[model samples]
Each structure stands twice: as C-alpha cells, then as structure tokens.
Target: MSERANAMRASILRSHGGPEVLRLSELPAPVPTSGETLIRVGAAGVEPGLDVRTRLNGAGWQLRFPHVLGASMAGTVISSPDAAAPDPGTRVAVAPNISCGECAYCRSGRDNSCAQREFLGIHHAGGYAEFCSVPTRNLIPIADSTSFAVAASTAVSFGTAWHLLVTRARVSPADVVFVVGAAGSVGTAAAQIAALFGARVVLGSRTPQNLRELSDEVRALGVVDTTTDFAPQLESIAPGGVDVVVETVGSDTWAGSVDSLAPEGRLVCCGGASGGEVGLTLRDLYRRNLSLLFSTSSTFEDLRLVLRLVDEGRLRPRVDKVFDLADAAAAHAAVEAGGLQGKVVIVPESAA
Candidate 1:
C-alpha cells in the first residue's frame, strides 16, 4: 500500500503462431492511473478464445496477442490512490473493454459496438497479474452473497449476456429464447439471463452432454426446455418460431439459430466459436422480417442492472474450473475443450 512499493507480476505471449509460445514471466506491476483503480486480481478467466488464438494464430478470428492472456477478472480493489478505493474487501467483477468514451459510438450510447474499441487482454494490458489497473467505470460491485470468482466470471461473460439479451434483444416475459452452443460460458450466461427476464429458454448444442449441462444450469435458474436439435424442437415449442435467438455459437449453428426465429423474432449475437461464416438463404430473412441485433458488454447503466440482479439473488454464475496464473496455458486448453459446465478462471494468487 505504499506509493513506492514496486510490484512484480506476470505478462505472457505465445509466439503468436502456436500454443508453444504461451509464456509467462515476472515484470514491474501496474498502478492505477487517472480514472482507474488498481485491482489485486484474484482470478482471470482463461477463455476458449484465448486457446484458439494461442494455438492457431487467433488473429485469424480477430484475436491479437502480445498481451496478457485473460479477459475477465474478479477481485477486491486494493488501490485507487487519488480517487476513492472501492470498499476494502468488496469483491468486484471488472468488464475489460476500454473504449475511447468520447467517440461517436460512445456518445450515441453504443460503446460496445465501437469501431475503435480497445479490448483488455487484446489491445491493452489485462487481468493476469497481482494487480491490474482498470477504469472505475468498468467495475461491477458484487454483493456480499456473491463470491469473487463468480463476480469475476460475470464481468465479460455475464456482461456480454446482459448487453446482448437485455439491452439489444430485450427478451420479454414468455418470449421463447433459443441459445445456440448452449453450454459455453456466454451461452450459459445468456440462457440464465434470458430466463431471468422471463424468456422460455431452449438450448441447442452439438452433443446431448452439452445440452444437458445447460439444461441443468437453466433449470437451476428456473429455465426449462433445453434441446439438442433445432428444427423439430423449435416447431415443437414455439411452432410459430422462437422470439429471440442468442447466436453466440457461430458457423456451426448460425444457420440453425437463424432458421428457428419467428417473423419478428430477433437474433442477438456475441461470439462465433464454431466458425464465422454462416451461409443462409435470403428467402428465410426477407419472408420472416427477422432482425439481427448484435451487441456486447453492459453499458455503465446496464452494468448497474446486472449488479442489482446479482444483489437480488436472481442470477448466479457457474464456474467450470479454476487454474493458477502459471497454469494459464492449461486453462486456455480447458476453454477450447468446451464441454465445460461453466467458466474457467485463472487465480493469480494461484501457487506456481
């Protein structure tokens, strides 16, 4: 807690061409600058995207490296020096995108869709450290009832869900929401968040196991009706079609996700795990009046709502597994493996 107390932490890069390049080493720790807070990172998520980019030159999918390997983090605020430190011992989940808030997209309240958005763990230094600085605006206060790990899992994973489903998709009571790739982190978050908004959640994935995991989480969250097939299942449930399609499971299921929508049904997209190219016929879109609503991250306002929901105990995050900072590579491997029941996190405090 001293100003001159130099900090040592880890910074990683995998040669940008293969997983063998994922390397970690100690470096001077970060300090919070203006409008930022120095969070003593408890855990950082080693997501599936991190593994793909590490192993396959992730830039192919728009992933950039030479940065810390995690995008989501949960921890207590340790310092804000000039500004007020977030209450000591308060577990805070941080949303990582740092956009130039003065830009056109930002002023229009669409920061998540900003063209020049600087992503943490992508364009900037991120959460895989003893202490990483983040904008005060990016922190979401987790209730005492929530764990640091759960809160951290929400920052990006849940925040993205909130933005896509609540903000853009705007699921209403009784809306039939079909979430594709229904078991990934975002998929799981979307299903729970959608159901909390009163949507009847339907989950579709490649395997019954994946669908089963999501069904379990959904039911625990009060959502039922998870399915592995889209065509017959959609016809069975909505008949007319699903009211909202949360399309995070790219390439592999986009066509199906899109096909399951109703006349006015909206599609809120986030990630593209399977592949990016989704080929569909114009006949389906033009005839149905289907809307594609793409979004990401909870706004400052959206974050507040999500936090309130957490406080109300209406939403809970599921953890797949946790790894220490040194085992970051393994964590990424787990995410890419994908049959996970929930999110994978990296504990910086994890013993090497």
Candidate 2:
C-alpha cells in the first residue's frame, strides 16, 4: 500500500557455502496472507546454528534456494489482515517456530515437540530483510522500554535456556548447573536462568575475556564461577561434580559434560554449534545414573516468559555488535570467528 511496502532490500543466499554466499539485493516485499502479518524488521540476530547449520549442511530441513537467513528478529507490525491481531505499528518480537496447533503435543503444552513443526528461517523466509510475513500467532508484544535489538536477542537464547534448565532439567536451588560455551548467548542465558532459580552455576568458555565477563555478570546475580579449562577446573572447584550440565558445544563438550555430572545428574543439550557427533556408552550411562535430554527450540509460552523477564529487568541477553542488513556477510564472518560473548545483530538499513 505504501512505497516502502512495494520492495525491500534483503540479504539473499543464492547458494549455500559460506559468508561469501550472502549477497545484498532488492527483493519484492512479502505480503501477509489471511492469518499472517507483515513486519517491518528493525533488528535480527545472526545465529550460527540457524544460519550456518541450515545454510552449510541443510540442518536436517529441506531447502529452497535463494533463501533469506535469520531466526531471531524483532520489528513493528506494518500490516495485519487479522482484525483481532495486534494493531499495525505495534512493536513485537518474532517467535520463529511454527507448529501444528491440532497436534497431540501442541494440545498438551509441548508445542516444541509438535511433529509438524517448522522453523521460520529454515522452513520458509525469515527476517534477514526489510519486510517479512509471519503467522500472527508468532508475534510477542514488546514494551517501550525494550529495544528491538534486545527483544530480537532474547527469544532464541533465553527461550532455549529457560526451557532446558527450567522445564527439562528442572534445575533447583540445591543443584549445581554447569553451562558450556558460557561466553556465547545461549550459554550466558542458561547460566542466568540457572542462577535465577538459586542454582550454583559454573560457566565454561575457552576465551579468557568471555569467561571473565560472564563470570562477573553471573556472580553479580548469584553464586557463580568461570573456567577457561573446562574438565580439570571443574573437577578441582566442584570436586563432587555438578547436578545439571547444559551443553551446546556438542561433540566438543559431550564427553566432558558426562564426566562432570554428579550421580543421577541431568544433562540437557539444545544444539551443537561446535560439532554434532559424539561418543556415548550405554553402560557408562546406566552405571552413572545420568539422564541425557535433548531440548528442541522453546515454546511460545517460554518466549513469553523470557520477554517478561527481560521486560522486568531480571534476564539480559548480550548484544555484542550490530551490522547493517547490507553487511550481513561481515556479520556471518564474525559469527564464524567465534569467542564472542554476545549476539551479533543485523539492523535493517532502513531502520539504521
């Protein structure tokens, strides 16, 4: 209906390989279908697993080439065909996971496990552009006190972290929670949520600076410690081992996470941003009485709670840096570089 509504600038991935595959181009703006809404994207987080995993190796999802790649996005709703949806101009955080509402899992409050679930960036077009369309059910309202970048940073990191520690593992005050990749966004969020529930947190990261910074932040919130040397340091500090371990580095930390857990401990894993495959033994698992759980992406209710915590000033997701939408290649390069203590956000040039 408006000039900006006609066409938009977007980072298009014509073919998947590396950051070099991302190209800045003009594309037709997406129009909202009957139950969908068109958002003018303000900021989107460049997540490695969503972008790289899906882009490089397809990440178990069937592909459509020339796709836009971004999962964590926040923006203003410019058009909503659904009369009962939030009014146009409402600032909202995008919930990028779609699930079949009629599924048994969906009706049972386990939408994350809905058999017919699809991720936004992976299954369809997502927020690496100026304007994008999504189902109205995916929008999470944001407060004026929240910045678009901050809101965009939370849904993925905090939602997954909250679900893993709070819902899956059921971390408690007496539990000692160990978070791998503590400098990364998900790791940091996991540590924070664990601390919020009164758990003793042990943060592990290879980067000295990331460990230092995250350790400081967690210590400020509750009892916590950081380690650059994961297994050895964990053994020395927590001699008896921890009750819960949150691992995202996958193959890199899999063995160590198993070794660091206490008897009957719970180990929750969401992603393997580092490497996927890892060796495991059935005898070791049964003997140790350890429970290994895999957490998929979080639910809408999880996203809502994360937003509420952020809005209330209890949880904070790191925004390491921001890149203009046109500079998506550089953003991907930074993500690939690793050792970052926060999320790398891409702001639409129109918004920037």
Q: What TM-score, over all chains together, does every model reach?
A: 0.87, 0.95
Question: What lDDT score belongs to each candidate, Candidate 1 first?
Answer: 0.71, 0.85
How many residue-pair clashes does candidate 1 contain?
Answer: 4
Displacement of the residue 281 alpha carbon in candidate 1, Å: 2.6
Q: In model 1, which regions exceed 4 Å deviation?
A: 2-4, 50-66, 84-90, 216-229, 350-352
Q: Residue 100's C-alpha lDDT in candidate 2?
A: 90
Model 1: pairs clashing at backbone N, Cα or C within 3 Å = 14-21, 14-22, 15-21, 53-58
Q: What is the clash count of model 2? A: 0
Worst ten in a row by lDDT for model 1: 220-229
- Alpha-carbon error at 150 in model 2, in Å? 0.9
C-alpha RMSD values across all candidates:
3.4, 2.2
Report the C-alpha lDDT of model 2 over 71-93, residue by residue, as the tens digit: 88999989878987898889999
Q: State how far residue 51 of model 1 sits from its true place (Å).
A: 6.7
Q: How does model 1 score by TM-score?
A: 0.87
Candidate 1, residue 101: the lDDT equals 84
